[model samples]
Target: MKSLLRLTLSVLIISLVACSILQREGRYFSHPSTISKVDAIGSIPVRISLEQNWTDQTRMDFWFTSQGSRIIPYSWFMWLEQADSRALFRDAGHMEQLRYLPVASSAVNPAGLPIGFALDTDTQTGDAWLGLTCAACHTNQLDYQGTKILIEGAPTLANFVLFYQRLVNALTVTGKDDAKFERFAKRVLASDYSAESAAELRNSVLQISLAVAQRQLVNALPATYPADFTSYARLDAFGNIQNAASAFALHDLTNRNPPTAPVSYPFLWGTHQSDVVQWNASAPNTPIVGPLVRNIGEVVGVFGDLSITEAPWWQRVLGKKNSYSSTVKMLGLGHLEAWVKDLRSPQWPQQYLPGIDATKAAQGSVIYQQQCASCHQVITRSDEGQDYIAVKTPLIEVGTDPAMAWNAAHHKANTLILEGTKKDIIVGDKFSVQAPAIELAVNGVVGLVLKNPGEALKAGLIPEEHGKRSLLADELSSIEDYLQVNLAAREKLTVATKAASLLSESELHGLVYKARPLNGIWATAPYLHNGSVPNLWELLQLPEERIAEFWVGSREFDPVRVGYRVDQGLSKFRVRDDGGEVTPGNSNLGHRYGTELSDQQKWSLIEYMKTL
Candidate 1:
């Protein structure tokens, strides 16, 4: 036992040392000199009005409320530095440098931790944790002539990969450097500062830092694969989520797969109303259960604590199942879903941008009906309960990159560890030795929902029509229905594939990306599912004619082009498609619908899109 203890300690020390070395060598910390120059480039004062249904209080709740993701202890995040320097990691001045929008402290956000950062306190332990809310990735700000326009539900430019890497680096450094640890301890413990407390804090920081570092290694693309960075405004969400649930939670490294298929974050405006969501339309948005399951899965992916373990002997004897535990906040997730149901799309800011040319817009409206209206439907902004079933266009029909869809549809994982566990602790089925990664992820999320019945009930998971039924029965029915819908959607995609029989099952099922309503599409730049096209002007041109390379981290908008300005020297996130061997997730191809239009016709369509 003593020898084993020594071995474990040695391995941990070695890992921490390696992580510290990697932090020093890699671009994990931002230099103070490289702070963004966006604010210094003169300001444009303009009155902004967003046409959204939610009130000020709702928006505040959405922005700051926690979804039970605990990235780190709240106090540590408040005091950590940039690894090599004493500069605060959460400093607003360097927010733009990290591609996150900076916001002032308000009544709702006393910590002033950027737009998406939220404080979650453990109800049992009273420990405050810092985690991200949906707004971190969904809310966006565009700089038009030094005037910032805040758009709810739009994809943000924040570089998630960079943010996470820097955080780990800071924690690793604080653990290794005595001076940094002393300062961090002082800030975190203030009144309770003691030698024993300092040692305990150091151990906590090192353990979490090491764990996150190990997870990053598991999610990384194999050394043989090309370096495919997710960069700003994009994330391989499904890939990461599956990895967290199957590999990290299950303690099975072999279940890990490279998170190579990063896609642009979808806007949330009409998402709740849509029958399906996600780039591939894998999730079914069925009333209450649908949104709750989807959000819980998202929370799991974004550093939410999830643990899948063997069922206890007592549980087994009692026939109770599901040993899956998670820190997912059920009521918070439900509130967020409710808020999103009424969140309206941002209309064109006519006061800030050029006025629409009525003649051109009218002509473009006709072209839209002829060329675009079939797949991308229009939605009524005010209709909160309107059902908008998204149209799924096959990958062959809309020739965009098939990587994202393919990966989600086909990625498999070893479920041997969960073999005897109920497929969903609440309802139907049981796990086999092997299953799709998505299946395991769904199972994990379902377990979380079922485990917290009281929270689920409070979160409005029980539908009005099902109120008469027992909570367990209603929850079980919802899970079964949701699973069936997901299975049916996958089958539909598989059946619709026109690919040759020689193609794999993964390729067949991945042959579709959903076409959603284009309302507020103008705010979501670098178009297409993978965000390969830089602007609407270029997107209207042939895919072959589009710029092969452009930077993506800038928030400065080009109103004329209807996208963010892509300046090579100003941004670090350079998206390239040399047309040799297509980059796994960054292919700038397909969606040939409007590319053949005349320049005049294309410009008209662009003007018309601004109205949406």
Candidate 2:
């Protein structure tokens, strides 16, 4: 017994020593400085808006131009700049690589930054970070014949997964090389750093790199392959956001679920007018608060600073002594929502896609009014003069695919959000459906911090007040106050704003899809909620009659088909016919509403839709 005990002690000591050495010498390093800030920047037309109205155009331009968050720091993303010899990212013809970037008009920032990135200097550090904005996914361009028609709200074809995977791999590989680390340090720090600062910077970049690499590895594993390896253009947006929120809460990779049910990105042109938003139509589209919550969740999924490090019980017990850290810029959310609200649907260009007979379209309009107006028409309220789609159509089984709906319906968000009681009374009572506790909690914390900066300073939530913190807090508080006022004045409104105000949480999670106004439906292809059907014409056919499988992520527009060009060698991603390739929550076999229409009638309907 004595000998065994001595051996155990020796082994334990040795293990601790090994761990300590690994911590001190491991290639992965993390420092607070390495987590870059996404500060706001001056306007520099990364992409020009197609909108003709100056006010609306400006907002649309900014909306598509700015990055809402700095998910990856500029230095780490452009790590190859240290080489300066080879063309890091380039393409031969059509400037395909540059043109393919989600940035507007293929224009770079004034700093000659990459597409889909905006340069913003850290308010305190004077260091610039590349931030990604709404345009990365929301903006899209299509080539009709030889003319490039920039569609502001169409789903993007940018290969975000590959871009991120490459980024993670590059950063991790560079971090592992000590010689490379010296160059990275010099490049990222932009000045000579003390040994401590150098170590901190290297550690910070390594930590993020390793985390990303591990996630990519996990996602690539066979168990997660179907869910994670989604095709270009389509992504499991909500599922990933839910997993990200879970990861933020647990601070561990285990919390993340395999992202399944990759759905097409829904255009945002008329989202503000919807009674409830989301592919599944789960979230309420409250006037001020709802948009705020949705945007906050987006920022979190994209590596924004808002996170829940410890469980609520732990947080309650520890109070200011908790082990979590969160930094949020909730102030800008209202502005973002306001800007996006101004976005109008892209009008179909008659000049490019000519040969539409006005007589046929007029006949088609009569067909649309008779056959489709019941569900697809937008009604303007006589009393309020406000326009809204009248129906939040129930979970009618139209059988195109049930995957996205099923995932949205069956999502176990109880663990991801506050349940039973202890919900933040301020925001929770106002809305439901996982009310974005982390965001609201962060807002509540900001409210508290603004009131007592000294207490927050003591708690180490913020550094010394450089005016930005206080200003941001005040703005966030005012927004919060505005939401509260709106909630109180809900009775005065013609439209219900809260989720509970319109439908219960269970009802909100129903297997139904909204029958949105198909004004620009011609622009949005790969139809159905899951994007199973490739075109309006395809959508009007019987489920089995439709193309069983097709390729996505091609920007070549088919005016005749009124959808994206889909052929064998056309696109980067091949959407399989069988459910073999598609993850859970994606099936292309429902919504047989207009399928029974005669062939000529279907053509007429298509012609009419394009006019809208």
Candidate 3:
């Protein structure tokens, strides 16, 4: 009887663990929606046709869908069954916050994938792998009653923290399952393997999965990061990149700082034309080099082939190194950048929303020019018939929350290692390129190397290009050999050199934010650098009157408020006064422009802004 009970208990434990592995929910199925085809309805003038727009969307779809060799082989996520992956997706609770859209067809993506995910073939291994793209965080949808508004430039609402947590949980659960081991091994390593090889591969995958899960656990401990380190829609964009790049290059996880410097994702619309981009106005915004470096940085952040590990070098030398593959598709990235330049600001749907009062808008336009034009107006220049926006990188002190600026000012690149030596470069950490000309030189030369490895080999660029690979200028030479090879690249390099000539070396470290042209300002809300304010109306109020605490992450449009509706209870952010100074990154203080204006004046200003 005792032996029978013991057997029964063992059977129950197996069933429970099996159920945990098998249970899948929240699987997304693609369904066609008319949201993409909706008319601009007297918004901004579109340069491209709706069909062409759809084609651009298609290009965007491909860009977002194609896996760029980010993340690791045999991730716990790769082992998850379709149902289980879906369950993890659903459990993340991002349906409303991130405003995920349904896809049009199963033919486009198998497993009924959501907007952000698509199966990509590993270039070397010829195996299918899942990776993330720009759409996961960049694409946004707003529900205006029954109408769905698709805005591409606004910050994402997805809860990445939760998604990461679910992934860790999946890894933890999978690690404890002996029965699931064979299936995971076949899927990740090899289907037809000798018993010995399979055992080794299974153990390798387990080791990787377990290590990742352990890291996730360690990161979740409150002591790992700041107590106030909570990322909702906004992420510590620069800090995460720094940490990831450091981790990838060094393979030393202990030194990586937690991505605690959270800031709102700046909208991309009209950014290509800016003088200097990034929230902190750190990078040079030259047409050729700016976009190239920016995209490279982005791809690296998103897990593209930016790994400088020995494995990538080995793969580059040989065809494949074990299961790892690294390919930097520079031309493809150039195409993506060129495509993004065509993206126009979203037009305010005057027909769908309440039509703007034109007369009042005119009056507000007068007020805008009087009170706001000095800072917000676009500066243009024409030299010998060539016209361009004069990059006016003015650091205005409008008394908005200075935390982002402070954080930017204080941050340093302490962990970066110098190439060909154990010496680490003691450089100021920033989101922008520190030396624009140097960056262009490096990118132009290195980009060519990555583009044509055979030519690079023939040209004897192996040592210089591959010997000490990094994002710095030490390994890159200013000599004619690499730079003079490509005329177009050289010309662009010259152009970048001239564009950054006016910038002083000290200016590169300036923590000032760029005042972007307010073309579609009404569409992007939760104003201020940190996205602390919830609406334009609130933004116009005095610093004291602005709600000290509020929540973010809702797509329900409050057209009158000129921002997404925020419910204090349901919102993702809750700024509290802990009696001590508000956390540096979380403060809702400053940027009190136009606070002295009357209610009617503020509304009129908002109305005028919608037309721009």
Candidate 4:
């Protein structure tokens, strides 16, 4: 029953819990560790998972959850991972921690700065884990293909700074000055650096080389940080989000507190329709009908605990419920409850993604297989690579190998630890790095990676661009189920819609597991876990060698189109520091990387990708 809840959190197959609550219906506090993660005891109204709750055509909640789903204080999530062996799920803890960074005072405009960027000093003893979260990723932004966006799955404040600087550079007044860039980067980096240094030693080093650049950026900005001007200020004031959004805003809080319905994305392949379809979309809304898998799990922040379900969970590794009852301090505040609540965060505008050219996708698959298959397992096509999945694939940068993938993700994720510790890779709270895997963190998956990078990856655990250790291989597997089964369930509706011309057969709409068939690889760029990148041609054009700080509004060219001026790229780059000598940033985004990719290959890949 315990593993059931864990299984539910590990995948996105089916929705199990509602948006407002934390656990599945009838399930109580059930994290494996000292800090248990459960929903409010009988909190919400209807009982379905959130993904279905919102994505369903009705968009109705029989039970009313408070804010949208950001509540369940992240420290609670950290404990959930911790219960599973925090060191093994190192990066996962880092990521989940961000979701619950405390509001500094909840009394001012930027009441919630998130522990990472808060102006407070008392955070040392607060959820202390919250400070650890920022160190887990935000030393700087990940410059994928020269674009200044943060790593897709990992939300970083550095990207916001790069975006701000680029915008300032575009303005005539700020364009002429290079000093600010250096000043800005450094200050943020320093803040992050100082925040992450801890008393303990590590098992391995997972570092990012943002040390110098950080110094340069802060030194340049006059108003610098926490000022009314500059988006950097917004990041300082608002934490890792855009405009007025906070990942832990009031909306996110309320929904997670007393969820409206059961919202887990449980897997449904093996179960008999009668046996597994309780969350049906029929008049009664049974769960079974046409589900993705027999497994009742989820991918979003949805929760599920089989302890509450009719069936019994086979794996019962966790022993007790004390973890749920324990109080973890947060944001320098004491006695934080594991109780789920709602935090209403800001919402990004929903701009529908226009469809990509189908023809081009076909052309992209060949390249995709060659470059991407090493990490992503092809579920639809044979290993020899013969079939055609309609959409071009290539989103997940991880595969069936969990041990190794976790290691790779940790090296990238725990850069602050790498910088601060510069030594041993801490495995688990009790064990150090062992023969197979490298324990990367004292508390979570970081230790697992440090202990056995290879083994972890083999198990199929890799961080999504957002830095959560959910495997791409499994996601692909479920998507197949979701695509085929979900469609089958709605087959009658689809047929009726076409027959009635409510929508032409060709003009139909449906959800696919969040991936495309990647046979046509080249045309699918810009790449991202989230659809943040724009075009393939632009991706191919970026520089290969450097890990840059993607600046959105620099004075160079905008490889990806943007309406703003100063859409510069890597070419005209220059950085100054130390003795004030000018050094290069990225010359191009990532064009130079595909040295093996010839003009014909690149073109052919692009052409082929569209067909998929």
Top TM-score hit: 1
TM-score of each: 0.86, 0.72, 0.69, 0.27
Off by over 4 Å in 4: 1-355, 370-440, 444-535, 542-550, 553-612
lDDT of 2 by residue, 390-490 (tens): 35555545444555555444444323333333333344433244443232333333333333334333322111121123332345444445345433433
What lDDT score goes with residue 49 in model 3? 20
Scanning candidate 2 in windows of ten residues, the lowest lDDT window is 459-468
Lowest lDDT 10-mer window, candidate 4? Answer: 334-343
How many backbone clashes does every candidate have? Answer: 0, 19, 8, 207
Q: Lowest-scoring 10 consecutive residues by lDDT in candidate 1?
A: 34-43
Per-residue lDDT value at 25 in model 3: 20
* Candidate 4, residue 68: lDDT: 16
* Model 1 backbone overlap count: 0
What does candidate 1's lDDT look like per residue over 168-250, in tens digits?
Answer: 88989999999999998887776667898788777767766876676666677756454436778888888999998887677
Go through the candidates in order and give each one's C-alpha lDDT. 0.73, 0.52, 0.50, 0.23
Q: What value does the lDDT take at residue 551 in candidate 2?
A: 73
For candidate 4, write residues 339-436 as lDDT tens digits.
10010111111121123444544555666678645433344322212222222121121111121112111211112212323122221122222211
Off by over 4 Å in 3: 1-69, 72-99, 104-108, 177-205, 211-229, 309-328, 378-396, 407-409, 413-509, 568-570
In candidate 4 the C-alpha lDDT for residue 262 amounts to 12
Candidate 2 lDDT score relative to the true structure: 0.52
